[model samples]
Target: MKAKWRIVFLKEFRETMRDKRSLGLLLLFTLMYPVMLGVILNQQIKRATKPEREGIELAVIGAAQAPNLMVQLKQKNISVEQKGPMDEDAITQLLRSRKVVAVLRISDKFAENYQAMRPARVELWFDSAADNGARQRDIEEVLHAYNSSIASARLLAHGVSPATVAPLQLQRYDTGTTAARSAGLIGSILGFLFFPAFICGLSAAVDSTAGERERRSLEVLMSQPARTWELVTGKWLAAGALAVIGITLELFLAHAILSWLPLEEIGMSWRVTTFDLVMVCLASVPLSLFASAVQIAVAMNAKSFKEAQSMLSFVVMLPMIPGIAVSMLELKTALWMYAVPMLSNQTLLREIAKGEAIGALPFVLTFFSAMLPALAAVAFATWRMKSERYVLAV
Candidate 1:
């Protein structure tokens, strides 16, 4: 009803700019993503470069009577413990009880069988159905190694060289350039790191505008000489500004930590070239606009600041749905991926982080698509602001 809304918006914009909480959130948003990504990058780097260790826990009973076999198993990193020879029943129940990952029962006749050149069956008991296939593979490999060593010894007894029995060998050749392999995958994790910072701006925009309305302070604001659009626009831009700060920090942080992590070790570059940063910011515009619109609209519906806070908190949480859904579906950057709002960014951004060329078309389409929802929210919110119930504070 009054031009006071413009004055009110300016006041809020200035007030928010000065407030430490507002400043801190923007700073934290920018830093938070990089921090999160850095932790993951560290973990991945650790995983990729870390020396391999045996995962299966093997308990070898009757190891004393089969000391040769026991020594062979230890060389393969299998954990062996000597015990009285286990009967069939003891071995059976251990697997059922899950007392050990695998039970190695050296048959009581093992020494006799090997000396007689009879096939000695060392029983390995575990539930193949219940355990992971990888574990089974590990167990098989350990046993195979022992068998091969034993076979070589038997061959020596037969007056043959161990090498002569199996002279031929296989070697692996890798054709994948490190960059190609790294670029193919690391972006999604980066995307997860980067997305939530913008959520802070969205939350601020929603709480400040819609929240102000719900608080009845909007009446105080309406008493000044400001246009309704000015109020919305200033706050919207401020929200955008907050979004800009957050995203900029994320990029800088992403760059800073990228150099230290396995991302580079894997041959992917997260360095934000001038062009890359510019494109990232440009892509962020639609995201910020849409996010701001969401918060403002939701906050406007609230009747108190507390109510607005609660609602916007939930709004902050809404992005997780898309984040989780995209990850679970394992959808890559398809044509339709660009059509979805947060998800499109999530997909393409991974490419962006790894210094890959994501087309401008998807970025443009995603921004425009997101604007639809933002506009709808803005329209609904603006209308509510103009209502007798809101304006009259009835």
Candidate 2:
């Protein structure tokens, strides 16, 4: 004897496949989502790898008065555009136009002050609101180093050690690894990859539950010998199967794109191997199932196709909240993160990307966290279907 759920499952699955709109959406997301991710990351890589010394221009109001400063700026790859003496308004307008990063003004008393061994004032004019903070800092660093070099020379000429004036020395050591640097960026990207699981099966779930009821066909299907649980499980499985296939393909395509791109240039990498990828896909199966189960449970309550679609749209967005919260708070990966469905998948992928030895615990937690909720939703949907009010409405 055949299982009644299998009969319904096969029927719904075939119908979903025959639905051009559903299939089209499935195909579109499977191809486009990953390609979009690849394009975004590729742009980041290009930006990161671009030469920093290019495109930095500085305008000097009194260039001839500071020949030594010009040489220093030139050595730091800063192009000096010599300008005649300009008043404050002219310098402010030049900065507002953004043709140069900053304007360097040497006071007329600079040479006299230096000759008398007094303070020589040089002014740096910049627009703080501009997106040139890094460039501005680089220029300021060059000026600071130039000042130190001159101070050291003057002390040496006076038979005094340059170190005599310097009581303490400070140095910076960066202990951050490439993976550490990339964690936030790659983690954010991974969060979005699992969203297709919610989207791919939306049409099928809505159609089988709310769409069927609106067409008056669900009443006939319910009259069959199969129990409510069987019917609900069948529709749930059908929707889940589509989601599974879509998310799995999307992940594989994304993996290929990530592997092909030189993410190392941006200090990021998709370090997951084919074996690791297969494992991740396997673990993610329950996430698709959970999404489909929730869709089926909620969409089944709606009175019409449009109602279900609108309601399910909100349900789809629910999964994104956890992932977005983790990102906004910049939370570190913890075992508890594996208890959340969409967030679990995201955390799992990020851990895999780190190329670290994460044992089976995460995968197990990720799988069951989604699986348990899926089964519960299916149960609730079955209970709802069995209610007298539901049958009366149908």
lDDT of each: 0.67, 0.88
RMSD of each: 6.4, 2.9
TM-score, candidate number 1: 0.67
Candidate 1 lDDT by residue in tens digits, 76-107: 66566555667778877777776556787777
Local accuracy of candidate 2 as per-residue lDDT tens digits, 240-355: 99999988999999989989999888776566799999999999999999999999999878877898899998889999999889889988889999999999999988887777
Q: Residue 150, candidate 2: how far off, in angstroms?
A: 1.6
Identify the candidate with maximal TM-score.
2
C-alpha TM-score for every candidate: 0.67, 0.87
Show model 2 residue runs off by greater than 4 Å.
1-4, 25-53, 96-98, 128-130, 224-227, 260-262, 328-330
